[model samples]
Target: MHREKALDAGLHPEKIRVEADPYVPIAAARREILEGIVTQLRARGRVPRVCRYALAVGGQEPRHSLDAAAAFAVRQSWRIGVGQSYTDHHGAAESLTRPGWCLVRQQIRAGYADGVVVVTHSVVSPHIDAYKQQLNWFGAHFGFVALVVPEMQEWRP
Candidate 1:
């Protein structure tokens, strides 16, 4: 359906990359994130015997399932030990105040995983200022990196 719509909209089929919607409960998004992280780590010659990772997803409600995310990580040969979801239920919380965000920070601090896999950069907050602050905080506080999966909007398809 998406392919046909893109074709009708004058996008070449070859150029239409059908990416999984990160905002949906799809395992593909998780897989892609894991793959990208692994690739990045490999390029940096930081291959650990086992890739242990934690997941942090942000939204008023979970856009993806933790079980599916874990399974996807396992399928990629990664061991996901922690998973958390953050929500602005009342729409009145800062990025740093989210329980899930705090859990992620704790996991990193405690050395539970090599790094975190965020569903998107917006997992911190939708506001640009908040996002920048969150990124800076992660960089300054944690020695390891936090990898964000590519959002669907990046693809023209």
Candidate 2:
């Protein structure tokens, strides 16, 4: 559908490669988030500091998604010392409240990362209120901010 729209809009297929999957968007979002993080850090007077990353996405195939996200983060000059993905088949709460999040939090508290990069806000919850609440909770408890790529916003601690 998107490829067809691009073609209809006079975009040459040879000039664009389109994949009918979520990975492409996820990867793009990852790059954008990492770059945004770098900019934010620089603005805060942090000079060329290596950033460790934790990747959490909610889906059946989180491994593939996290791999793509991590690759893009590395390309964007993120160190990515820690990375993890969770399958949200059971529920967003189940995944969000699990050990993975705790481990990520631990890493941040231990001075491993400046913040976490979430692929999308929906990874926390589909509902807007829940998403914001969870972001706030993580920020408050972990003392680290989250960059929600899809929303292009940072949920601060």
Candidate 3:
């Protein structure tokens, strides 16, 4: 099914609150979370690990934003597995579900990390429920990290 169809058929979009603060910045929370995830992924190995993070940002400037984010991480000496896949105007994938799943799976494998952290620019949560299903299926087929979205307080380990 097309992304729009899948979403219209009942996919929950991403929900993020864009907090306003003079001391803080937009996407600051997201950047912090991404960096933290990258650090944790790096710590999993005895030696320096190749840390990669994916941002599934929709809209016109995904490449620009993703590149800047990746560059920031790279400056900190991360391996940085990066890629961008554009969604339709309705946040739907023009491609098939299988292909989308494959893209995510390939990225996960290439990163060789235990956990996957997904962030988005849209205030609305995007493709996570659907993405989680795909991740769960991929995990079953490959025996990877048992992906779980923990309760807010429980997310910190």
Top-TM-score structure, candidate number? 2
Per-prediction TM-score, please?
0.47, 0.47, 0.35
Model 1 RMSD vs true structure: 9.9
User: What is the TM-score of candidate 2?
Assistant: 0.47
Off by over 4 Å in 1: 1-76, 82-92, 143-157
Evaluated at residue 123, the lDDT of candidate 2 is 58
Better of 1 and 3 by TM-score: 1
- Could you tally the backbone clashes for each prediction? 0, 0, 6
| Best lDDT among the predictions, by candidate number | 2
lDDT of each: 0.48, 0.50, 0.38
- RMSD to truth, every model: 9.9, 10.9, 12.8
The full ranking of all candidates by TM-score, starting with the best, is 2, 1, 3
Q: In candidate 2, where is summed lDDT lowest over 10 consecutive residues?
A: 47-56
Model 3 TM: 0.35
Ranking according to lDDT, highest score first = 2, 1, 3
Misplaced by over 4 Å in model 3 are: 1-61, 81-90, 94-101, 110-128, 131-157
